[model samples]
Target: MEYKHVVNRIMLMIALFISIFLNLQAQSISDSSTILIQRNLRYADAPLEIGQDTSSDRLLDLYLPHTKPMQSLPILVFIHGGGFSGGDKGAKGNVALCKEIAAKGYAVVSINYYLYLKQNKIQGASAGANMKDGLPKDGKFHTGLETAVKMASADTELALQWIKNHAENYALDTNRLAISGGSAGAMTALYTTYRSKQKILPIRCVVNFWGGLASTDDIRASAPPLLTFHGEQDDLINVAYAYALHKKMKELNIQQSEIHILKNMGHAIYNYITKNEINTIDKFLTSNMPAYE
Candidate 1:
């Protein structure tokens, strides 16, 4: 009887210890993860707009935590989706996403890059066609929509460069950077991270939302970890690309990737980042990233 009593007492102590440890961890996360926004920080001068340098279209909103932890925060550079011709860093949905991610102890930069406007606009009819069939030109002549995408990717690269240059100002860890976007923004993210003609930054991860690749051949063993969210019924970008991405990663022995296909969903899942997905992203960024760039 005395032995059983001692055993029960030991079990209770272990349970208590675990509870205390978990509570401390929760407290730590809650304490250090409030958001602080530095709005409309111009990452670049507008080279395309008439008013150019004064235009807000070239700006970025930096979302970060109130408390800078011992280690610097990893950055997530977001591009908004408007078929490369529209979308803003301060859009309602974009703002919500930036804040939600910033609250997750990350530094999020939502950038407003150059867009295809006026005579440069690629009509909607061919836009979808160009998305799947118009990339990896590898020096082939670019179509209107393709050129628009290229310009957007270049702007995204500039944003990343800007973040790297201003890393110290925001306590950011450029070595652990990730790029993310929805629709057209997702395409820019993929291209900027993978198919850029010049050497882009060594991206640690990619968050693809209903995005496709010009060619899966661009992805190789050295590609960064990718987390894709796709809608099964998405007509704009289709869900097949997500499946193909998963298959290619498997073939390359790249284990740090995932594809989440939402049922009965469509292209504009801009507001789809939920608690579960956020947890997955947090784990992917922390667990999948290697020590080096």
Candidate 2:
């Protein structure tokens, strides 16, 4: 009958509406997603060899697009934070970040550096008994921090150099190398971006999440348009450090810097919150970052 036909048409229209709504939601989610890449390439060892030992740290984990025939992806090298004493590439929180960023289609590399405190002596054995003498006497632990940063930075730069020398192998767009990190990893990221001297092309952008600014002079000397985030309630690496650093950069006419202080947040807020801040950071990295070669 005519009435039955009308009812069937109405049902079809409703189903179509629901399908359209679901498709839109899926698209929105994809707008904020990340991907991962898994592979290792042979790289020159000298760039990573800062000491007498000329060994290559070619190990890296990349998170990028999930499509067939991999596209040329932007590179993001992320470091972890364990006070330079202990930390691993497989750490849960950092791995989550790597996966998240990779889902967004950018290549992310989470790396492990040479840790300073092993058995306890200064540069002690990798696995051995406790050596209390290895511990710094004063509250200051600069030696361990310095060694870790140096190793991490060297590895990062070497990775970049390798990417440059073999760009076609990794399918990475060499022009868009960006560095980011949290805590001590933040120190390594910021230092590598602004403090160290490497032969590769300058890093295009830098992001610091809940990290401190060591010294302003070096940062200013090679400042590459910084984008930093910190939690206002972060007691671990006081928010003031970020604020003061921003102020100094502004004073120095470094106009392309930005800082976001999350209200009522604490250290490592990115790990606690939903991926909203992550999306913002991705936009900042991809869209708002300053122009650099």
Candidate 3:
């Protein structure tokens, strides 16, 4: 009986030890990831260019997980909104979104593309419109705006090329790339996805925050999944553009696109991507890129 009791005690102790070890292992496995950022990495090869508030700095900030880089991290390239003439890569509000996304194990590349505006006013909407200050229409932005979009789109392509060149060094999975932007930056994202000529980087998803497309006519049935947030009271870019984009995608049978309109809000909805919305965005990415699921 004593020997049997001793054996039972030993088995009980072993079970407890195993349970503790398993708990520790589980905790370690589920440990939160830390993010590390490397800033001011030049992406453009052209002679170092500068713009208002360093807009054409041609630099990009890379955000990655602080772990053993196995060259497997998916990339989410972000552009800032400044009407193509003002914003920089280090804007604080947008940085919050970038960091939060990075913390979820994505490599976020916030880049600086050439700004297209500086005290310049491009034609608003189209000649006939309704909304604020009339129509983008209905019609697309004028030449200056169009040129800015094209230039910014080109620069964004260069940034993708840069990301591809350094993919191995940063554990970036170029095959799984997504681009996002706010306001003008959002327009650039759409341009890069549908208009950019270089096929070096294939975008899986787009998160457009208060951005207007040059024309919904540019999108096709095969375009990437879109997730957009627009403020109905947007004073800069009209909400009609967002509706037009959504309508176009619907017509094309692109079922994965979605739009969220915020009432009484103006432009700059990117700054207000709440925690819930972030989760939704993350889910959108995961769903679009099933590998992340």
lDDT by residue (tens digit), candidate 2, 189-258:
8778767888686687788887664455566644676778888887667776678668767887767678
Residue ranges of candidate 3 with Cα displaced over 4 Å: 1-33, 46-53, 69-71, 119-138
Model 3 lDDT per residue over 156-177, tens place:
9889999999998887888889
Worst 10 residues of 1 by lDDT: 133-142
Q: Answer with 1 or 3, whichever has the higher lDDT.
A: 3
For residues 34-134, write the lDDT of model 1, one tens digit per residue. Answer: 77788888777767554542222678889888876668888888888877656677778888777877777789998887776422644552346654433
User: Ranking under TM-score, best-scoring first?
Assistant: 3, 1, 2
User: What TM-score number comes out for model 1?
Assistant: 0.79
Residue 130 miss distance in model 2 (angstroms):
23
RMSD of model 2 against the true structure: 7.1
- lDDT scores for all predictions? 0.76, 0.66, 0.79
